[model samples]
Target: MEGRIAAKAEQDGAVAAPRRAPSQQRSRERVERMLAAASALIAEQGSDAMRMGEVAERAGVSIGSLYQFFPDKRAIVWALAERRTAEGQACIAAALKDVGDAEGLRQAFSGLVDIYYGLFLAEPVMRDIWSGTQADKALRELELADSRANAEFLVAALKRLRPKADPAELEATALLVWQMGEAAMRLAISVDREEGDRLVAAYKRMALRELGDG
Candidate 1:
């Protein structure tokens, strides 16, 4: 439910900044094509094996045009990750809108898990992208920042679900929920599809139990 998007800031030996963002409609469309091409390549081959030239060729844009939006492969991956994160957040926010109690939270969590499972299944390259963030310290910081944003969103949802709960405890609980949910999702995707569904169901029950849901 977290670990997406980045500020493209200088941190811990990572790139000092992101490439210039597309300013005009045509440039934006080209950037979209480049990112789309990169994603397709990453899905077909691991990110490490993908090349900028290949992406540009697949996108039908000049290599120079691709570089105009993403200076390197990492930038391409980062932008893709950012797009995925934004999508994940939107899904969670929409799910939360209908959640009103522990039972609602349980159902919403099940849906959330399903969404993530589908996301990973559909875009296998995201698994590698996530792993890369762990090996790179600066990307890990970006991930933490992304997680914090998601944590705040979780906290807001929890407040709506259990308004009588202590604010401090809710904050801590929200963080735990996010971490545990993320771990569960990773595990779920690592197993067979049917087994993954079972795992997600079990996690939903366990997580709801932790929140005092009967």
Candidate 2:
């Protein structure tokens, strides 16, 4: 994954802090359960409609326990966002690990898109977090910043694929690709299943062409 991307996000203050850090395995597990319950609520309703007490109840923890990890809905959302972003980065890293040619890159990109699409479809919380981020100014800014970090990761991968390419151009293209993928994802979810598959395929073609491939 893009190890530095998350670090850069933290450095830039895009991440929100939890009420307390999970220090022990048990604490971490408790916090995970709380977040999981919160995710279910956010997925069922919206983040604004999610209640802390209900989250604790669903998690089988006390209300105080929920507050021990997350202070508010915003903190829960941020943690979820961070988790999702990390998963996406891991997908990209795994997909590109064995890529050696344009065809390989295309396959890897396709895999990356498929993984993200599945994630969003399977987890309503992911969709909610993405939509929420776009609607909030501060979150929108953070999303854009994270996009850039993801782009830089892609730039590094592209350099491996095409070492002769111009550095500046590669950087620009990577950012464009990353943003395009995001847009495609938004559209994909809003449309029917078959159409969404076609849309994703089209995006793969465009991404490959922009990367100086098919």
Best by lDDT: 2
Q: Per-residue alpha-carbon lDDT of model 1 for 1-214, expressed as tens digits?
A: 2222344344344643446877899988988888888888988898999998999999999988887777888878777776777777787778877677777777887778777877777777777777576676655666666566666777787888777888888777766776777667777877888998898888877777766531
- Report the backbone clash tally of model 2: 0
RMSD in Å for all candidates: 2.8, 2.9
Clashing pairs in 2: none
Q: Give the TM-score of candidate 2.
A: 0.86
Query: Which portions of model 1 show Cα errors greater than 4 Å?
Result: 1-5
- How many angstroms is residue 137 displaced in model 1 relative to the true structure, after the best TM-score fit? 2.6
Estimated TM-score per prediction?
0.87, 0.86
lDDT of 2 at 96: 70
Distance from true location, Cα of 8 in model 2, Å: 8.7
Q: lDDT of each structure?
A: 0.74, 0.78
Q: Compared with the true structure, what per-residue lDDT tens digits does model 2 show for residues 1-214?
A: 2334445544666554476789999999998898888888987888889988889899999988888888777778877887777767666766776777777777777777788888878888888888766765545655676678778777777888889888999998988898888888888988998999899889988888888651
How high a TM-score does candidate 1 get? 0.87
